[model samples]
Target: MAHKKLQRFQEIKTFPNVFEMPENMAQRWTKHFNNQHPLVLELACGKGEYTVGLARLYPENNYIGVDIKGNRIWRGALTALNEDLHNVAFLRTPIEQIQQYFFPNSVDAIWITFPDPQLRLSKAKKRLTHPRFLRLYQQILQPNGVVYLKTDSPNLYQFTKTVINLFGLELLQDYDNLYAATNLLPEHTIKTHYEQLDIAQSNRIHFLAFKLNQTLPIEKDVELKKLIEIHGTD
Candidate 1:
């Protein structure tokens, strides 16, 4: 497994769809896709399933899968190239630095599928939906640009709700059990390997779609910390 991982890491460097911290990446995006289509990002896109899936569903839009693991992205990059998914691309970078690669108001939407819940209170800041990450998302996301979260973790679902409420973000949609809900869209149909494993063992998938506020206040972060300390049981 180690040898295979090393080989994939070396191989992805040559892939036309993969970019690893390339300088002035924001300027190159338009040239890469050769169109002025809307940009959508799938953060923590393990295997780039959602990224590729969304691109396939919406040919009018461009999708980029952002993850730090090269070996994991190799499968999606290869699949995109093999299938000629011109709208699909992969970026190798930590989610924390996501804003650095995209210019202000450049991103149209974001999807975070099956990300780590960061159940421990001590790790709350690391959660993708945390205020810290939201601030980063706000930097690049267009005004009222939607952010979607799909997870099997009840804790994460509730935690994100708290952040949205506390931060005054617009909650466009919320579903505690996505499969049990009606009028599901095409994007909801895509599932990753981790989702199949049911790692959370919660059986139900939670989904939240929201828009960030114009500004995520710094003072509210202090309040958020206090609330988590008092009420956070996970």
Candidate 2:
């Protein structure tokens, strides 16, 4: 592994603000904070910009940044420690294993910020909005919990909208062009590293928020598959 990555692995081990597959994970988490504050998870939280940002915005809620990369997680973990953000924590784990940490209905909401669109049709199951992941999210999420997505990829934006429609989910908010509107919400203004480096240079940022329907059945969309097959995606 890279030197920085090795160092981060060693460093985060001691971070009071970070947790890595801890014992009694769920019980300890709620007790550590000594409150029943709503827990919000940021999946694929690269460097935890949205995690820390949201923690700062909503002090009443606890924030956990979940990502597999120790090196990337170190930045946000240390930031929370340095700033004394007691409610902010980073979880170094693969997004696929989220259910291992939190109990069902324990999480209040989820945020997926600038995640890989998994643009290719072959990678559809890997997309964060894919039915497989959504089902996993639903398992742990509170009833009617909302999933918020912020991305610069129009394909991912539309793909999520399609999933919502296909699954009969409740669409709470949909901003195709986030910056184009006047009165941008504070949470909407937070930018992730990927947003600056790859997506925002030319493309407009998009925000999608929807609630998971517990009874929604899973089915592949042939029309969506054809769309991905015909046109390339961002």
Candidate 3:
């Protein structure tokens, strides 16, 4: 297993569809994809399921899955190559440094699918929907761009709702139980490995779609933390 992982890590470096902590790519996605189509990102995209899936679904838009695990990325990158998914790519890097890879207003949309909930109060800042990451997302996302969060953790689902309410973000859609909804989109039905594992045991998928139309003030984070401290104990 160890040797195979090492081999995958080394092999991905050569895959034309994979970029590992590359430099000077902030404004070059269009050039790399050789088109002006909209660019969407799936952060922490383990195995690039959503990346390859979305690319297959929406051939017009480009998709890039961002994750730190080169070994895991090999699976999706190879699959995309085999299927000739020209619109799919994988970026091996931490989500925190996402801004470094794309220029301001370059990304059209972001999908946070079944990410780590960071349930601890102390680690709240690490949550993808936390203000810290939201600030980074705002830097790279277009003004009209939207963010989609799909998770099985009830805690994360509610936590994100609190952030949206407190930050005054526009909540475009919210479904506590996505599969239970009468109206469902094809993209929403794309399930990841984590989602299949049912690790949370919540027995339901939560989905939230919101726009960062309002500013998320740094001072507001203090209030956000306080709220988490109060209700987080449960």
Candidate 4:
């Protein structure tokens, strides 16, 4: 089924090296956007379900779906093109190097959906909500930018909650089972492909939202050298 999906959307807009985006391209992007629009980024954005949906729902805001898989992002890119959506874009890249592409305080919000938990203790730094990645997110996000996360892993949810609390960040919402929540906005409650599958299987879906406060203390960087010594370089 995943293979068929990839085959269907093969000929769509895709970047070969999203992380190494040129400085000139950045200038061009700034010129194209004129710095007047709000930018939302969806990290590890698979097929860009949220990105396309947001483009349709909030035409005033611009959305970018960042992911490493070209085939996965093709569907979202094609959707934007087919719909003539001027507010959406797609970038194919590893999420870890996101800071290389976006300017500081350029992003207004972020959506993270169904990311791998990287469950090994030694791989903690590779997690999207880890201190290192959070630092990168802080560099790109606006002062009051919000982050939304949806995942099926209870461990990831607990780890993220702990990290947020430890850093004194505010948690807007934390639900172990999102479908059970009656208060979510209709727009905010839409599920992604993976999310819908999980729901159909009677699996609990976790979700959380939090604001980025510039005043909060950033956590100390994890020692990558030590991590490497313990886990070896992958």
Candidate 5:
């Protein structure tokens, strides 16, 4: 199984712990690439298609793929290691706990690919773009940094768009059909594993890109906490 494969990879090399104090992040991260490069994170990076592809595309930036499932991220980590890619790394942790790891304004950008929709109304807080996660991202992402979401779920696409609009944040792009347009740049045209699967099946891919507006007045944190407590029970 995938989990077993990940466990094997974990045994080979212990991943650095990012959940430590903020002062430690630079030491840990910079040890690999130093401070001159920008940092990018891929949340819920399943199989690491985007992480690997992007790292290949942007050698000047450092890429880190964060996911709780070690098995899921093993492919990405191994690929980076095998390719001797100095600019890409993998972090094994829950995406919700991301704020506890990085310092304020530390990351330059974020890519969220095929995240779960958490479709039920009661499960809204669990969505990656929900206010709680957004706040966490704000704490780590640089002021002008952006978050990119690519998925096949229409509900999630609409829900995230609505949230961005309600919060008065800028929506740079809302592509309901990304591949239909002819002007796609090479950087944007590279596909993830899931995206490739979808393409082969002739399915439309939805994408949203938005910048982080630090000045926006976010609602109380208690709302998300309450939602998590009420709906997160297994």
Candidate 6:
């Protein structure tokens, strides 16, 4: 690792708001925030712009940014500490192991911001919107809890919508051109570094929010698989 990254890794260890493989964390986030506020998770939270931004917007709900990279987490954790954002925290761990850390129905909502599109069919399972990953999310998410996705790739946006339809998941909002809307929410206008870069490159940013109330069995859905295999090429 670079010198700066090593320094950040060491620094994050000292932050009381940051946890690395903590135990007794399941359904116990209320103790961390010192209130019974609902918890929201930002997965694959690179630099945690969403975590910091949303925490500022809604202090009533606690926010935790989860990513395997300690260096990226350092920025958000330190910012929360410095700003005295009590509702903000960072979890340094792989998103795949989330069930081990959080109990069922512990989370109120999820946000996956600007994640890699995982454009290839072979890498479909790695996409955060993939059924396997959704199942992992549902394990800890409360019933009817929303999972939000904000991304620069149009492919991921459409792909997630298709998956939601095929799996009978509720599609609460679908903004193909999120910024084009006349009445945009505050969260929609909060741009991340990647979002700014995408705008400069003329790549459209997409947003999708849905509820995973029912089971999403990708194996049984032949049509969805073929759709992925076909449309995943672009």
Error of 6 at 83 (Å): 0.7
Model 4 weakest 10-residue run by lDDT: 13-22
Full-model lDDT for every candidate: 0.93, 0.85, 0.93, 0.74, 0.75, 0.86
RMSD from true fold, candidate 5:
5.0
- Global Cα RMSD, each model: 1.0, 2.0, 1.1, 5.3, 5.0, 1.7
Span of ten consecutive residues with least summed lDDT in model 3: 225-234
Every model's TM-score: 0.98, 0.92, 0.98, 0.81, 0.83, 0.94
- Tens digits of per-residue lDDT, candidate 1, 1-234, equal 999999999999999999998888989999999999999999999899899999999999999999999999999999999999999999999998998899999999999999999998889889999989999999999997999999999989988988988878899999999999888999997999879989999989999999986588888877887887777634
lDDT (Cα, tens digit) per residue for candidate 3, span 28-75: 788879998999999999988888989999999999999999999999
Task: Identify the superior model by TM-score, candidate 4 or candidate 5.
Answer: 5
- Candidate 3 Cα misplacement greater than 4 A, ranges: none
Rate residue 154 of model 2 by lDDT: 86
**Candidate 6: stretches off by over 4 Å:** 199-202, 232-234
- Cα lDDT, model 5, residue 202: 31
Candidate 3 residue pairs in clash (backbone atoms < 3 Å): none
Per-residue lDDT for 1-234 in model 6, tens only? 699999998999999999997888775677778897888999999888899999999989999999999999998888888899999999988888988888898899999998888877677778899888999999999997999999888778878988898888898888888888887889877777678777425356778899998887667456777987776622
Error of 5 at 191 (Å): 2.6
Q: Tens digit of lDDT per residue, candidate 4, span 101-121?
A: 787888899999878778677
- Candidate 4 to truth, TM: 0.81
